[model samples]
Target chain A: MIARLLMSLTAVLIVASVLWRDPAAPVAQPHPRFVKLDKHGNPLSPWQGPWSCVLDTTQQLVWEVKTDSENIHDGYWTYSWYLSGDPRTSDRARGEANLGDCYFETSRCDTQDLINRTRQAALCGLTQWRLPSAQELSSLVQAPARPGHAHIAQDFFPHMKHGDYWSADHSQPLSGHYRRFKQGALAVNFHTGKQYSLPYRNAAFVLLVADLPSEHHSSRTSGVTHQPTTGN
Target chain B: MRKATFVFLHMLTIVLVICSLFTGLRFSLLTQDWLKFLSALLPQGNLYFWHIGSASLLSALAAGYLLLSLWRPYRSSPSHYHLWVNRFGYLIILGLLSSGWLLWLGRFVAIAQPLHFYSLWLLLIYLLMHGWAYFIQHGKYVLSALLPKQPDKHSIAAVISVTAGGLLLYSAAQHSAETLTVASLAPEEFIEIDGLGDESHWQRAPVYTIETHGGINFDDGRSTIQVQALANSQESYFLVRWTDSSMSTNHLPLLKTQAGWKIQQNGFYEFDERTFYEDKLAVMLSHSCEVGADNTAQLGNRPLDGKPPNWHGKGFHASMDGKIRDLWHWKAVRTNDMYLADDNFFGPPAIAQQGQRRYTAGYQPDGKESGAYVMNWQWYKPGLVTPKRLPDQSNAHLSVLPWFGSTPYTAENDDFAPGSTLSSILYRSNRFEGDRADVRARGTWDNGVWTLELVRKHYTGSEHDVPLTNGTCMWFSAFDHAQVGHTRHMRPAILRYPL
Candidate 1:
């Protein structure tokens, strides 16, 4: 019985060793700063910060809490604005929501209520605002110093951690990570525990807008052209 | 036996992988776009990590296999397995060396015109050899026969297989790591002139223009120009003007003329100038000027100009701006003594004769010659008391006199003979005197041609003589005894005359 057990144990050990030896395992290493691709490769989306969503029209989509000017941990303050259109379909709501938790930071607060309020605010606008698509978010992943960033031209959350951003576009199985400097796109596995999020309703910072005239109907949610809000 | 086969196959595969990785990495470095894409796929950090990981894994596996094979008790000794593995390892190494040499030759030498095909063939051959070896070793019952033992053979095979697999993985990792580092830092572009002519006569043109189909903006400083001539099938001469400003101008010389025309700082200009003889040759000169304040100008002299004139024409007035305007003309005349002859040797009293009956020689008053008899004489004849000596007697001891009088030979009329009457006169004398007089006159009745000979002996013992007919004449100096005496010597002897 002892010999049989020893033999079985040896066999098991051999089998286990073979199985554990993963030839294709990626060695633990720092991620590349710029993810280049061939002509056929797709672009990555912006990062998703610490935020959750709930459909509510009564409250603002993203509210900031006033904190110490130097430190974000001091306290909270509320800044409000009226939504001109439905939060679900308005360009303003889409643009604001696609920024992820860096600007929204809804993960720590009432995520569901915040999402609902965002949708309501977008719907309240004279024109509709909705979440930006993957392509739209990708377009914003330009070099940090490019000229087209008029309103939100500056990175809204300067202190936000740098990594891959989540996009509404789920074309690829792996989530996209947009690089900061080169604006390169990378496909990352969300399950690999490499994701980070931003907080919501933080007002110690400022929120920019693209103020368009009332005559134009800005309800179209095509990922092609969505200007940032001009007003505060 | 099974253990040996596994080890052999694993080693062969590892060698092939390494070679392929090396070649691929080199290609990637030469082309930047490919390198960039590769880097993204396998970042530097990951490449290094994987390299270390794979090497360790493969080494561990190989060691484990060896150990297990050694520990097992087999009917056939482990020596047989060891021998097979050794043979297989040797073959792999040989194959790798051969493939590497072929690749290196293709890259560095012109052993073959189309190296790509040769390299590909070599790679294929290596693969085939590897596959052939694998098949032979893995054939059915080969391992069993070699092992000849039950439990020992199985355990030994297991260990060898594991070890080989680990080593293979390790080799791949190392290759990948090397490739990642080298290719990431590859150059972006290789700049070369596609149609530049031969390097020897390459001319630097002033302006180089590049036209790209796409709207690409090149930094002004980084650009260069290449110019070629279609007519001569040669590179044109030019100078590069690197500057900070945008505008520049220059003046270039025209062909065949000493004077060049004023050309704008940056455009093509043409001009023509007349030669001294009023002959005209077209001068085609071109200048390319870049528009910049810091730009400079260079003048290219045509290849024919040996020592180019210093921007000034002699005997011509030039303006303050270096322009040649007016020219001055000068004339010169020369004179020297010469013996004259006529068609007939017996024309006047000034004639003299001295030679034998068949061929008499003398001097005549006219310059034309008529008969076959010839007479030669030297001018500036030496006096009886003093024999003339040549100043420069290095080669021939013959005295030479300037046919025309002394005058500076100018560039304008250098083509014509100095003593020709058409352009200038050299010498003329009226008095005729000599040692004594001797005459031989002959007249041909049929052709009305008369031939005569006359000789004049001077007081100084020197004599002048000539043979002449009605239309023929000859002249000579009797003092030239070095020659065949005055009888065979004469000056300006006429050789031919018409009836």
Candidate 2:
């Protein structure tokens, strides 16, 4: 009888222990705060969006949306690193041009030519289009759930190249002689979310960005063609 | 000495029951959806180790106790009530042990699972009744008898022998599992990887069928896969067929609405897309036949330390032990037209990257030579999207868009009318050229079934691929238009080759 009582007590304790697990805590999911803008710099409805540029309200930046139309803004186009006037050498040295493959009048697609063309065209009703800083470009990356997938949010920035996009950050010389070390610019690889410094002659893709002024941020959002809703 | 022996046996039984009961419940949650909520609290990595180890020890202890009782009959007698309770307790334990072994061996699981669970409840009840009576009769002083001055030498010997015997049994069971034989093809026989099992050679080959369970969008969440393997001197071919009520080929198609283009998906945000997904089949090969995907499936919110948790909480498949397992994946929409199975492998956990929202642990595709497919849209927003390409013709709905068949997307060139649909998958090339295209495969869907045929080299010598040789264990899983949800089965079908 005593042995049986002990066994019963032990069994109850064992069963209780197995059932005494703590529930997993719920994770918090926040809503995205992005607004889409058209070529005329007008905010488009989230549902009716085929926007030319994306305005990231949180970051106060307007991002260029690439296309696949074989034009200067085509996502598949690549450009060589060239600045009209070098910062270190001033006007003495013009970097390599006409080394990249792109659809342009002269077909001489370089970083300087692209920057000049974008400003002249005043894309998205803004002439401040230029290469984004390394930090700014990386901030646009939303890591994919799976490996080997692209890093940007496809919903907002469609037609983006899966390869590297050049940043405005140039790698400075660490030692005494600036000419001794190879000059390069920083680029962000969207596939792996890693930053790389490429030689000035190496061709890469580009996406222009501009700062959104405080006055134009809220007042220009007039034409919302559809109801606003949050989605993945 | 007698008192010490009794105490030792009782203590051993208690410990074994505690270990096996908890681990068994953990495993039961995998198939028993009703109890799935309890899994959140249970520890979930390599649970089979503890369950099997304790079960083996318990069986050995029971056998030893029975033998000793038969060897020397006890002269003393007990009350009728006490005797009946002891007999009933032993019966319940016996039922539990037998059912447990049947379940582990993957035999008659439909019957064994419930029987084992009921026997556990019975054992608990028996213990309560028996213990209550003992305590009532013996009073408080009866506890002192359990702590003998010292454990007897015989008791120590029994413990060592029991442990050794249990380990031996476990090792033997691991090696001697049933093997599925791969029949040889004659010189004149021919086979094609055209997603058809109508070849005469396939008709002559033996078929191995496995009943799978626990996948969404299936009848009662179950499916059965029938597999046939044939080999020649240099190549091996496999024909796999499974039943699915509907043929789902539309994989996240883009719909052009009055507002904009939106992807047709039900749960893409959570990474668990059940609607607008394609049916898929995956075949994995490994040297070890350990259950639960060779122990690669680590369950729980955070199974691996310092790793990002999976979105579904189902778990992740990663070979943390540095061994590679070959995987062949066939998709209805993605790889069906390519006539190839995306050759992939399970390797060690990948290093966590910065800004990665979803981290696919260990699951990686093999190196591809050239051709591949990419999603049609530039970015994905559940509400609206801008497509990467527009169909040359308006209102054309295709399961996959060929690169040459479509024009680059442009606002001026946008001719798709509202309410038109386009395939989300875009082909970069006709087919793959390198190691990623090693497994030439094709699948066809008929009234309610899918027939898939695959052929690969016997030995490609790639570091990521396992050789199609004798003793290689294989597992098959089927996804019925679901992302990250697949039908699973226990006990791998090990390969055997002709001498």
Candidate 3:
């Protein structure tokens, strides 16, 4: 009987103690697994060197870093959803062209114009820059509780606007019918963490991404990809 | 029968007292940061009605006990010590009940608020003393002695009747009192829209001043706003005045750097820009008079599901229940020159749109006519930005630059010296039209105080506006040069049109 009484008292004290614990206590939070890369795509420390790109170790993808300078990668420039080519390859209707505003020499400021300029410039010593897929782009959104106004990581992506960004995904039909899927493309609003399909002529911001080759794939835990010294 | 009555009454008192204490302390914690630890343990969200309801029940219980004791006085307690303990508990309860009732009735609140707060501590001491005295006398079976066993049917009926009476009284009190009456006054002359409240007829209108707290750049994060409303047959006029140390009119001015022009800001990256923002005031009108923004303010970072967390961990304001609340936003730099308040509303969460920078949840502006103001930048970057327009002449330091007086920006014409600042607000038109220009307002800052005058039609006929009718609940907030950070008050000052 005495043993049972002692157990009951201990159980009550434990419950009370747990209830009284301070909610503000700092529990261990998972650190972001990212590798910063310089202009020529060289790995650098989290606190050192001017970086032009970020490598998400978890997703094993190379993402472009927008800038404030008057260049093709200027963050303020906006582009409409347009690609002048065959409709079958795009999985949707050929979007309207020359409807966006940019710092490029060509009057056409559509998504295809940005892609051509980025490839010719070979930013981050790679020529494979393209608009990211919806799932791939959304992976960059930091956990909801993280600090900063924009949903993405501010340290990796500087000059980040609170506007919607265009994704490569479009409102395509489920079957192989390409003609029926001519409505619009998908865009992600980082301000509210929401996705919506915008019309083909609607202007939005863009962020490019590239795939790492199989030979260049680093360890899964810390996949930091360093480019060769020779320019691409 | 006596034992059963005593047990039932004591048990009822315990439950009502606990409910009142928790709900009351939660409200007191708003300004009393020292009692913050008690917040995690107390009930959250809309505690005002619960506090009032429990007080009504407690009052009914106390009155019932008094009548019963008068009819048949209690036998003398076996112990003299227990008798004195019971008397001390009664004294503490009396203090709590009297102060609480005075606060609920909104009479002598200055003294009653503190009296009611301190009485809870005395109640805690009384509970400890009473429990200890009973435990010493009754030994191990103190619990069994207090528990009522097989109470007669008459006693049960009495308990039910007393509870029903308390609930009925609470429902009646909810409908009456706590309304601020806006008297109808005939102005001797035309009321000018100037920011001066010095009209002779303004003196006849009654003034309601509320002390709002918790915002940056205020006097200890607190400021008292004085509001007076007057209505002719056609239009309703309002005069609001508040104290602000500095006249913050320097909005996000662009500073020319050697690299280029960069928008001047401190925390705009985090959407909590305190410096270089405009001084503003906001007024919200809602049909329901519930506290905490009609329970629309959801606290915590990620309060709403499937929605991004707020930049600041404080909270977000979204009308989840689909009720529309009209908001009038007046900015010193953006709208002061136009002599109009930007009409806005809080409705259901908006569908996210492309190219939109900020997703303001349920807060959105009412539809406007063609002409409006826009930021004077081709694109905004924290590091550098290219201006959309340049000053036509030498006057480049104005807070708002007119579109007709400026030339389009060109590299060759960019002759401004480095470190020079330019205004960012580019006015396309004089003022807003349509439903967005419903309220005509003007404000003047003099000697550390702002006097603002506003006037609108009695019924705007727009779906976005709430008609100036009787019992229209209104709330006022002030921003001292901070964006999205405004001082707030708990209780709304309801509007009453003179019959």
Instruction: Return the top candidate by TM-score.
Output: 2
Q: Lowest summed-lDDT stretch of 10 residues in model 1 chain B?
A: B177-186
Model 3, span A39-133: residue lDDT tens: 77676544433567777777777888886545678887888887666566755447777778886756758888888887787766778878889
Candidate 2: misplaced stretches above 4 Å?
A1-75, A80-113, A116-232, B1-6, B31-36, B65-100, B113-149, B185-189, B243-246, B250-268, B273-276, B369-371, B375-397, B401-424, B430-433
TM-score of chain B of each: 0.18, 0.83, 0.72
lDDT of 3 by residue, B271-315 (tens): 667899999999988888765466566544344665544444344
Ranking by lDDT: 2, 3, 1
Better structure of 1 and 2 per lDDT: 2
| Candidate 2 structure, TM-score to reference | 0.71
Give the per-residue lDDT of model 1 (tens digit) for A151-178. 1112222221123333332222222332
lDDT of 3: 0.73
lDDT of 2 by residue, B65-139 (tens): 887668753344669998999899899989999987775565665666668888977876886677656667776
Residue pairs with colliding backbones in model 3 are: none
Better of 1 and 2 by DockQ: 2
| Number of the top-ranking candidate, with lDDT as the measure | 2
